[model samples]
Target: MELISDDAPKSLELENISRRFGNTYAVRELSLSIAPGEVICLVGHSGCGKTSLLRIIAGIDTADRGVIRIRGEYVAGPSRFVEPEMRNIGFVFQDYALFPHLTVEQNVLFGLRNLPRQDARTKAMAMIARVGLTHLTSRHPHMLSGGEQQRVALARALAPGTDILLMDEPFSNLDRGLREQMRDDTLSLLRSMGTTVVMVTHDPEEALSAGDRVVLMRAGEIVQQGSGYELFHSPNSRYAADFFTAFNKVQGIYRNGQIHTPIGAFPSARQLREESQAVAYIRPSDITVTTAQSGLSGRIVQRVLLGEIEQLAVKLDGLEEPICVRSLDHRPPDTGEVGISIRSEAVLTFPNP
Candidate 1:
């Protein structure tokens, strides 16, 4: 059993990876490069092919056309294919996938089969301890809590010192509180180990907060790839803009680099023909409620309290529906006429359908 060489290649590269099931393509001609020790999240709606792509990278599913290189060595290509066990990559499935009959210690030892008996046990115990589950090493999967089972799964996947780790919605099964805690704990461990990771998640907030880079996919192709802030703040398409959060879509006319809506005019960065119909997307949080004389005058017609945040629906003169505003003020005015102003920098515009 040897430690990973410091000079070993640490990047994962996929070039033109494609997979098809019958007449439908699960993954199109997709290509991405992951740097050493970088964490990348794949996010999209259901049936968007994120899981299919992960399986292809793991060697569980074959790619119809493409190249996969791990640690700078070709693992899947035209003339060569490496077995899953030989690829030195670890996978943590969504369900954890622990053997029901095996004890925690035995499960961790499964990945170190090639090592000598004593060495395998020693390494497995060390990993179990690293996950803070040393006291439960003899416990079977049925007897452990979900978080404990998650730790066991992580210990097993990491026991062999694999080059890259892949996770598919690893924390989705836990409760909200537990999910957040487990995610933070797992991230801390991965950061300390400096492991390169590729995670697939349908959760937008998780994708934004957890990954060094986020890859957003749609219908078997990547729509955008960049830091979370870049994708959220500077989305390339209307689809990308609508994916991250809720928006108050205002229909307007595009003229002179601005969108003129019923209530007010907002600047747009999108190029459009003059007088063309455009839609401005403003986040609920980006709308400011002011005194009656400050901005566009509107009457608050509805209010809903959402824990620390409050949602207010303001009815303007020309709009068919009231515009929603989210505010952090504990006791916001719920029944008065108010002025509304939008943040120009946060506005996203697209050509109306």
Candidate 2:
């Protein structure tokens, strides 16, 4: 792939954008800017407006309000709107969306039709080779594997030489291993081409690993946006923490910089008002099980052996909630009794209603 022009602007900016469907607000007052060659992943649960937001960005859906700028040029706003084709954005749909009757080469070349026939054919062949699908150029979509079909779809989207690529659930159809492989491969391709990409996914792991930054969305608004490490280590909201990973929320009261809960009184680093109700979040991995007598007393209710780690559900004394702990070693105590300690530094506190 050829290097993109440094002088060319590759930024995609959304300023106070909002979209609605009659009585329902699909996306409510959202704003974010993506830099040139940067990959941003939008993640949230279904009906959270992630797809609607993406469609608005792609110019497929008109926003009810706000401005969109591509490379510093205004595209959409209160008084103006740009057509989808005029925006020069490449889109990969969830279903591959490949033309069933067209050959792989023809499908890729379809986007380049505005160019000279010979030049369009040349670009299509180059994209096919770049995606490692040259061998299946004459094949139809039905003949290829899921991964191959996805690659063809990607090639078709990229064939237009658009600097911006938007992919919606691109890897959802693949198996676990294949999904990972495709994600890695797709990232490699995008980075190599210096393509500015915004992909929408509900998978936390995929969003964390694939994008330069992850934008966590909920209820038609952006709840958190940061690097994977930043968001994982210090999430701003309970929604972000729970969405990113499995966490146990223990409700308690905060007093004198300490949280008093059924498990035990523990010092909290999180800033909180005095005598405030709060929820302490502890990731399953942060809890440690020890054979020592002195620790939080609990009864092991269940043990599940995952390949890389074992998950134990322990019912702590005086606490109705079951605390979950994960460990690599399978030396779990008997189902009747277990002792576990919460790591002080790993705890996160959130305001309780």
Candidate 3:
């Protein structure tokens, strides 16, 4: 891994990018700018165009309309298109696309065919060792574990010394425990190399934990984007709020710019018609269950222990469905009756549609 040049251009820039398939648009007038060495995670549901956007950036698919500039040079636009191989962009596919017959070193060396044989072999060995695979350099893909195969894919993609790399759900194939380890290890390696990365994933927690910036897309358009803290703490809409975590939506009425629900009155951030319907988004963790009668009266209908936290389904007096509350207290109240109080500051208010 080498330090990125200070004089290098912006890693990537997409202006009004769009792609269509028959009557449906996969990517719609999407625009984004990525800084050099930044790690960005593209997250959304199945048909949100996240993978489509990644393919366009890697030149695997052409944009129907827009301009793409990589490292300050035009790559794709209305009048020009660069071949995927000539774009100097590295891509790690979801399957860890390695040749079954090629050894670890040989797989990496394949990407450096443009260099002399000795030089390519030397650089390939260095990349293999950088990913901690020097001991398995002679092993083929079938002989390696999922994590090892992933490392080989990364080594091959990065051995070319390309500053920009695109990964599509690189860690999705591994099991839960191994997935976290591989994700952390992979990120550390990419950051050490000062590589500009655009990774696509459907997991919200992964997107929040892995990216320097998380781009949330919906229906082929960007719904919201910012740091993990920004998207989690200050979502702009109900859709954005629900994507990050589960929220207990409490319907309320808008009165004098405030949402008045059965539990409490919360400040509304969005302007709504007077007397129209409003909703409060509250996280299960944000609600506290107390034995004292200081808050709303609710009876615990069910309780389940989830390792570190205990989840309780509390049914309020008038609410149709029970609201869920998660607590980390070692001695959570027994399943029977409890008082529910929401953290006012953590409440997110939006208009009911």
lDDT values for all models: 0.91, 0.89, 0.91
| Better-scoring candidate (lDDT), 2 or 3 | 3
For candidate 2, the 10 contiguous residues with the lowest summed lDDT are 1-10
Output the worst ten-in-a-row residue range by lDDT, candidate 3. Answer: 1-10
User: For candidate 3, lDDT tens digit of each residue in 205-283?
Assistant: 9999999999999989999998988999999888899999999999999999788998789887677889998898989
Q: Let me know the TM-score candidate 1 reaches against the reference structure.
A: 0.95
Model 1 per-residue lDDT at 173: 91
Error of model 1, residue 203, in angstroms: 0.3
Clash pairs, candidate 3, are none
Ranking by lDDT: 3, 1, 2
Count steric clashes of candidate 1: 0
Q: Write the per-residue lDDT of candidate 2 for residues 113-175, one digit (tens) a residue.
A: 999999999999999999999999999999999999999999999999888899999999999
TM-score of each: 0.95, 0.94, 0.96
Q: Report, for all candidates in order, the number of backbone clashes.
A: 0, 0, 0
Error of 2 at 284 (Å): 0.9
